[model samples]
Target chain A: MPQRMARVSWRLLLLGVLFCAAGLVLTARLAQLQIVSHGHYAVQAEDEHMGMEKVFPPRGAILDRNGYPLALTLDTYDIYINRKVWQDEKLAADGAEALSSVLGRRPDEILAALGPDTDGDALVAGSIGYDAGRKIIEMGVPGVKATATIVRFHPEGDLASALQGFVGRDQTGLSGLEADLQDQLGGSAGTLYFERDSMGNPIPFGYRQLTQSEPASDVRLTIDRYIQEATEQALDAAIEKNAANGGSIIVMEPKTGAILAMASRPSFKLSQLDLADETKMELYRNRAVTDLYEPGSVMKVVTMSTAVDLSLVTPNTTYEDTGMAYVGGYAIENWDFSANGTTTMTQLLQKSLNTGAVWVGQQIGPERFYDYAKRFGFGEPTGVGLGGEAAGTVRTSEDPEWYPSDLATNSFGQGISVTPLQMITAVAAIANGGELMRPYIVADVVGPDGSDETQPQVVRRVISESTARTLTAMMNDVVEGTPSHGARVQGYHVAGKTGTSFISVPGGYAPDRVITSFVGFAPVSDPRMIVLVKIDEPQGERLGGTVAAPVFAELAPKILSYLGVPPDAPALVQQGG
Target chain B: MSALDRLIARPLPRPFPRVTGVRPVLVGAFLVVACLGLLQVAQTSSATTTGYNLQRLQDERFATQAGVHQLEAEVAVLTSIDRIDREARGRLGMVPAGTALTLEVHKQPPEQQFVPLRFLSETKAPQVKTSSWWQRLLNLLPFF
Candidate 1:
């Protein structure tokens, strides 16, 4: 009996020890969860039970030189549908139909977006108006939701659209200056944290924390709103009247290299940008800096400037125009296929004589001509602070394709290509007193507290002040002295050249279509603005003098007045020697 | 009146004897419960005030933001070039002047102004629009 009692006692003791071991393990686990790793588990629990949200700051504003806002942000709401809440197919269809009526979207499309297979929420429509969003939310639909969002708005509509460009649905820049200055315009985002219930609804009087977002900075451009509007209106009228395919105009402050105005046709309003339309996408290109053309007789200024800068030729220097010049078996003739026997440099510019240009190029020699061209910024980018800027093509005598005849054709503005920006920037050197200024469109950046000013930069001096003045005087005669040569801006001493080039076909030049252009600067005594008007393929009158010159005559005076420049000309013509 | 008489005379007396320390234990338990109750009331009132303050601040912030947004939108529309031009032409009855600036390029060039070669633009004098040296330096900062 005593032995049986001992066995039972031993068994009882073993059971007590096992129970104690289990109790100790439980206590250790409790301590670990409640003390050792409390912070980690507590944070995890808070994250799981609390609701969080991402808040995106408003994108930056794009303003004109005068602080007029061109692009800005507006508060908007996006409608979404909760698929889980409206799991029933019929309920989902009914909800979609109600939303469709309010949002002006197809009910079938909304239904497909929130179909039974969907697992989460779906956006019904973006940028819904406040009234519309409120009405939809009030419909008492099972799954309807509305969240606040920010959208980009352009109040100026299509004015300078090609240059200002447009943003996407989420305020992402797609082209032009918007694309170039994306980082400065897109600000950093932040987040919000708060407690939530089992239904994922924000808990009333719940714990809340906020990490504030930084607002984007504002960009102020050198584009004067007044000038840009006037340019657009003038270019649009010229395009319609001439029945030309399209056109572009660039106005610049020669001294500052500040782009006062840039306008192109076929531009659309930012608010109405439709990316799906192919034609709209085609018009998205900024033609002033992107399109290339032969530039025709407008190039004569470069050839003449090259010769005059070398002191090899003067305005009175005589050149013989034999109607046709032979170089490497290639015949280079005047534009009308006829030429006067003897011509002065002034008369050659007035008439845009091709043979005269070739004679001047011959006087300067190929080496000097090519060097001057390079100095004038041909065959290089102007770095004008715009996207899609094209550097023109220029070939020297070293290339295998270089023929003796190219000197004649290139001097007369053919067998090479140039963008309007390049052409104007180079010519601006002559107008700006020999200094090649780096052209920029942005004037400064103004944030909330202070402003950052953009100082003008000089690339290099291309000629002496005397040479630029001399060239300016010779060009002046092209408008005022030439008989019926056109390109006259009344009340202004305008110096410019006209170009009419036949559109080059695959093998040779087109017989019918032509590109006409007029480039000039005004108030020869002071030189305020350099203007270039390029019209492509006008219907009736195709000469640069007839089609493009009048546009300059129309735009130059208005721009000068807007800039507050007083008229430098006397009412009566001065009697002179 | 002796001790034996007092013990027998006290009828329906304390079930827990004083010497057993039951009275102090009961009093201590009562005090702890009252203190806990008072602390809970104070905590609840503070949380309520905090919640109210948060809600009011959020509402005020939203209202201010809305006002700013409205004013910004109005400014954008009012400052638009197209709007200004239309107002000038329609409401103000303005007419355009001539199509050219008066300049004479025909005759012999005037005694050339002693035009000097300038490396940079001479149009805007640096002193005209800028502030003090410290202000200019501060303006250069991106987030000044």
Candidate 2:
């Protein structure tokens, strides 16, 4: 009896030991599932029921100041082929033939885009018209599908093409204002989350949440359509007539510093834009803001204006011209190399004499000359609200390359570089009573919230109002006194200065190549518009007064008549009659 | 009295009732839990229905926005300056206006009024105003 009882006790003890070991193993597994790998399991569970998708909003449209669309974002379609489904020879042929008919491409071309018969997706046709894409969809071709896409379109057919820039395949701005204001032009994407079934379709009754996308702001540039067209036509005509390499023209509202029109030659047309051609990359730059050239005699306006503002010289301040001024052992002569014996400050400008300009620079000296140049927004960018702007090179006495001759050359717009924008903005300061305003391209921005108009911002006063008026009068003498200058208007007292600067080469200046430019404003009493015309290397008539001034003379009258400014010199017109 | 006789007399005095199996507190707790479960199920059903409706509306809005964009593109094309210029010159036989001739109407100038120099400038024109350094520093304060 004792033995049997002991055997039962031993068996019960063994069973208790086995049960405890199994419980410990179960507890460890439970701990791992609940605590150690909890996050992993939780994410897996969420993946079974939840889904997220990104929603893209349309890009903004670029409009002119008067609400004319220049660049627009329009919905198109991208036709794609499923390579795995197209592996079937019959389905591939049928779909390719069907797509080719609508896409205006060969069947083999479509098939080639599809690639080898494998499991992948390929874009057969991108940015096809909406009507044609819809037709392909209606045909219900096998192994093919059309997805919606947004494309950047220039509706005006290359008008302001360089200014509008272009976009990449992913709908991102690549250049110009489009690249500068990407944040404002590109709308933010949104997110959507919902419960999904095993097949990745939204459940019939699922939890859904959406964050709506913010719409892009419409950018209204200060460009005027009529003025832009006229400027382009004028530049084209000038380039063709003079057989020049290229040119740039800019029209500005002096009072507000609003850019009315900006055009550059040798630019790509929107209809014929081919990004693969690398030779045309140089044409993509907006020369008005990016290219730097010795502004030639145009810098004399700044030099003379600085002297007049400081009471160092007056328009009638007289000086002796020996046909040449020796500075730093170099002889500087007038543009024509035949100096008048006695030249007044007014005559210095009327004749565009380099020797006279050197005399005035001597009065102002280099220290104050560069300071005033900086004040006039030279040696720096105008900050015209564009990308890829060149600040321009200014060699001062402090630089290693400086010589005393640089002061004289720079006095008449040489040995220093300035973008066309800087030249025009400086002249605009004189046109608008000496207040230097920050030039702006965007006039307003209309968004989903409200409209924001860009107010004119004044940088600072570069010169006194009295000095501006005095300089304006002197410039008027330069234009009206020299009727052969080709900048005179019949019934308008136009004030202008012409520049003829030689192109600098590797070691010295190019003997025959010159970049001629004219900067002018009309109705000098109360100037309305200021224009800058720069021609590069004209075949003949290389002087600014002859080549560039005539273009301005042709464009300015049309612009003034459009603005409805009353003629200040009706008597001059009557005399002509 | 004898013990046996006393016990029998006491038993006859009262017949106690048998104890019941259920408890009132437990039953009340179970009823409250069941009601909460039902409410949760109803709420989930309502939410799922609302989500379906929202999804449908979102799709419709997307389609309508796309249509509006299409129409806008069409209008932009039709009203483009290049198109108008071409049509005006080619179809309508129009020419650019000639050099403008102005007819002078001699009239007396308007009488000038004595106005303050400050008021003489255009109100909307940008004005340059200077502030003290202290004022500029104070503007940096959040509540200033």
TM-score of each: 0.78, 0.81
Model 1 CAPRI quality: incorrect
Candidate lDDT scores, in order, read 0.83, 0.87
TM-score of chain B of each: 0.53, 0.45
DockQ of 1: 0.18
Every candidate's DockQ is 0.18, 0.21
Deviating ranges (above 4 Å) for candidate 2 = A1-53, A90-109, A129-146, A193-209, A571-577, B1-53, B107-144
* TM-scores (chain A) of the candidates: 0.85, 0.88
lDDT of 2 by residue, A1-577 (tens): 9999999999998998888888988999999998999999999988887987665578998999889888888777888887878888888888888888789989899889976648767888889876777688679786677776688877777888888888776667888888887877887867778887654545656666779877789999999888998999999999999999998999999999999999987788877878899998988878889999999998899999999999999887899998999999998887778969888999889889999999999999988998898999988888888999999999887888888899999999998999988899999999999999899999988899888999998989999999999999999999988757788876888999999999999999998999999999988999999999999999978999999999999999889988888788766333321
Across B1-144, the per-residue lDDT of candidate 2 in tens digits comes to 578778776656555876665666678778888888888888887876777687678656756776787788789989988888889999999998876677665555559766877878666866779899999999999998
Off by over 4 Å in 1: A1-53, A87-120, A129-142, A193-209, A398-404, A572-577, B1-52, B85-144
